[model samples]
Target: MEPFMSDLSALSSALAATAAAAAPSLVSVHSHRSRASGFVWKSDLVVTADEALADEGEVIIAFADGTTRPATIAGRDHTTDVALLRFDGRDVSSTPLARDVPPLGSLAIIVAADQGTPVAALAMVSKSAGPWRSLRGGDIDARIELDTGLRRSSEGSLVLDASGRAVGMAVRGPGRTLVIPAATIERVASKLETHGRIARGYLGAGLQPVKLDEGVGAMVMSLDKNGPAAAAGLRQGDVITALNNAPFSSMRGLMRELGPDSVGAVVDVAALRGGEPMRVALTIGERPA
Candidate 1:
């Protein structure tokens, strides 16, 4: 019984130490009555969850020391749920990110800030898998799910591994808490820093799903004269069945193939033109903001 009690006490102490080490990087993001967590990414940049940020409002970042500063949205990507903010203030050091994904069932510490006060939660890595696509068609580098009850104020908190190294940023997913892995942050945040938005592939045709004899298809209802669909010779009323040899039964399924990585790639389009089968090559273009 004494040994068991000692083990528990050691674990509690270790968790407190880890939380203390990560608290300095955390900040509370406030915008138009919406509050969320964020962390210092670079010298003058902070990263937070995009979904929690309001579209048009003055944003403020409150540090653990109770100091606050006005920040501007440098860049934001809805697909990855990451938003970068640029602020004028003293530089805060960011925690080291783990190069590799943490193993399943490992200890995970969630460090967040609530209105400039530090908060912590302990969880375990419930699921760890390879790269996956979000329902919105964003490509995430790794799939990491945590078994923990995440608070609304901790949406963009820093998720750290047992060694106190950051694994990723914590965000609320469809009824669950998910970690946007470190590799994904590095990829998307860097682009956001440069371009302020992630480019997505666009076909420039308004499509609606329709039931066909064999399966489902997207019928083009409108066309942009100067868009990729027009360049591929696609006209209104053409029912597209497949793209690049993969069949899609819904509009979302087809759009899933047009993620950021799909931009600038040429694809083979399979569609029916006036009851006749036709094939055309289309070069995907960037979607207009």
Candidate 2:
């Protein structure tokens, strides 16, 4: 009984120490009347959940020491649900990110700030899998789900592994808690910092789904005079059946293939022109802002 009690006390103390170490980087993000959690990603940049940030409001960053500062929306990617805030006069250091995904069933700690005070939750890595795409067409590095419930104020909290290395940022998924893996944050946030928005692939043609002999296809209804589709000799009334040998029956399925990672890719487009099958090499263009 004594040994068990001692071990439990040691575990409790270690967890508390982990939370304390992350407290300095944790911050409470307030937009309009809503509040969410965030962490310092750089000296003057903070990362928070895009979904929780109001479209139009004065953003505020509250530190754990009860100090507040005005921040501006540096950039936001709705597909990835990451928003970057820029501020001045504060020198906050970011936590070190874990190089690889934590193993399944490992202990994961969520650290957040509630109005400048640190709060934490302990849970296990419920699911860890290969890369996946979000419903909004963003490519996630890895699918990491936590066995815990995230509070509204903790939407963008930093998720740490047992060793105090940051695994990712927490966000509310459809019905569960999800971690946006560290690798993804490094990739997207850097781009967001340089370009205020992510560039998506563009076809420069209006498409309408049509029933085909075997599967569905998208018929080109209109084309931009200077667009990639027009440059690739894709004419109006052409029905696109497949992209890169992958047949898609819906417009969404086709769009999903044109995520941010496909912005500069060259794809083989299989289409029907006047019932004659033809293939064209098309270099995807960036969607115009």
Residues 1-289 of candidate 1 have per-residue lDDT tens digits of 6999999999999999999999998999999999999999987899999988989989999999999999999999888899999997566787667768989999999999999999999999999999998877889999999998788889899999998899899999877799999899888999999998999999999999988898988899999999999999999999999888888677777778888888999999999988899999999999998
lDDT of 2 by residue, 35-128 (tens): 9999998888999999989999799999999999999998998888888999894567777777589899999999999988999999999999
Q: Report how far residue 189 has shifted in candidate 2, in Å.
A: 1.2
State, as a TM-score between 0 and 1, how close model 2 is to the true structure. 0.90
Query: Which stretches in model 2 have alpha-carbon errors above 4 Å?
Result: 273-278
Every model: Cα RMSD to truth: 1.4, 2.1
RMSD of 1: 1.4
TM-scores for the candidates: 0.96, 0.90
TM-score of 1: 0.96
Query: 18 in model 2: Cα distance from truth in Å?
Result: 1.1
